[model samples]
Target: MEALNEELERAGAWVFGAGLEPASSATVIRASGSVSMTDGPYAETKEQMGGFWIIDVPDLDTALDWAGKAGAACEQPVELRPMQRA
Candidate 1:
């Protein structure tokens, strides 16, 4: 995360958001014959989403570029997905 943030810094971009989430803070809602809200994880899991980042870029290549940098920067996993034009 530190390294990735550094790359963004050199590029004049910054890590928008990054943090950890607890499994307890999450709730799962489902619509069935009756709606239900469950405690704890909607499903059993080990490690949940720890953190995330949102970076503004011009296009796909730019997004991928950032993702690659981030992946290399952190020992943990990193993912990148293009958002629909909004």
Candidate 2:
């Protein structure tokens, strides 16, 4: 993880990432004229999001390159998504 962050810094695209609480510790809230609270994961799945990183880069290609590096370093899948235009 440290190495991945370092690589992002070297590429001048580092942003920030926060570690998430365990899914069991998460709380879900819902509302539709009424409110409800669920004490657990938002849904059941074979996988769960552990954390995320946001990077600033010039374009999609650069972002994908960085994401590939991240995936290689962590031995886990990495997803890339472009932020909506302002």
Candidate 3:
């Protein structure tokens, strides 16, 4: 983990962001015609997002490459999503 963080820092790709709380600590909020709040995670599933890393890479392939590295380093799946552009 330390090595990965150092590598990302050296590559100028790490975008520091807040780490999410555990699923048990999450509060799900929803709104349409009216606002409603729910305790716990948005869904009752074993799979939950613990945290995220925002890495600025050249393209999707590059992002995937980084994701692969992350997966190997952490022994966990790394999901890649493109940023929405205006």
Candidate 4:
């Protein structure tokens, strides 16, 4: 993972990355007619996002390459999604 990060940094595509705490430690807040708070993930599912990386690559192909490396390093499936531009 460190090697991948280094490679990304070298390529100037590394924006930021981080690992999150367990889903059990999460707190969900909602605001509708009234504000409410709930414990745990917003939804229960077989898979959860353990961590993520934000990179600035030229295109989907480049991002996919990095995601593949990350998946191999972690021995887990990685999800890739483009960020919405402001």
Candidate 5:
């Protein structure tokens, strides 16, 4: 895990979040005519997502570089999302 963080740092990106939490503890929020909130995640099956990373980089290649390392650390899926431009 430390090595992954270092790699990202060296590449001028940074991990934003990470952790393990129960599926039941998760709540999904969506928007439409009115705000919508749902219980648990959309996927109720196992292989639940436990963590995430937000990295600032020029493009996908940089993001993938960090993702591969994180994936190995947890031996599970790691989701990546670009910081929204608002």
Candidate 6:
């Protein structure tokens, strides 16, 4: 993963990246007329996001290339989505 980050940095595609704590450690907050708090993820599911990376690449092809590298390095499937343009 360090190698992947270094490669991304060299290509100027690295923006930000991080790993998250386990879902059991999550806190959920809700407000609908009032406020409420809950423990764990917002939705009960078999899968959860373990971590993510934000890359600034020129096109989807470039993004896919990075995603492929990331998935191989982590030995896990990676999900890629574009950030909304400002």
Candidate closest to the true structure, highest lDDT: 6
Model 2, 1-86: lDDT tens digits are: 89889878887898887668778888888898999998888686667677789999998898888889888876779878888889
Local accuracy by lDDT, each model: 0.74, 0.83, 0.80, 0.91, 0.76, 0.92
Candidate maximizing TM-score: 6
Candidate 5, residues 1-86: lDDT per residue as tens digits?
77777777787777465666878888888898899998987774666877676778788887777777788987887776666799
* TM of each candidate vs. truth: 0.65, 0.83, 0.85, 0.92, 0.62, 0.92
lDDT of 6 by residue, 1-86 (tens): 99999999999999999988888899899999999999888686778888999999999999999999999988889999999999
What would you estimate as the lDDT of candidate 3?
A: 0.80
Residue-wise C-alpha lDDT for candidate 3, range 1-86, written one tens digit per residue: 67887899899988873357778998888898999998988675778876678888889888888889888877878778888877
Candidate 1: pairs in clash: none
Candidate 3, residue 84: Cα displacement in angstroms equals 0.8
Judged by whole-model lDDT over C-alpha atoms, candidate 4 comes out at 0.91
For model 2, the superposed segments whose C-alpha errors exceed 4 Å read none
Off by over 4 Å in 4: none
lDDT per residue (tens digit) for residues 1-86 in model 1: 77677777777666477786777888888899999998777576665776777787777898888877776666567777765778
Which window of 10 residues has the lowest lDDT sum in candidate 3? Answer: 14-23
RMSD of 1: 3.1
lDDT of 1: 0.74
- Candidate scoring better on lDDT of 1 and 3: 3
| Residue 56 error, candidate 5, Å | 0.5
- How many clashes in each structure? 0, 0, 0, 0, 0, 0
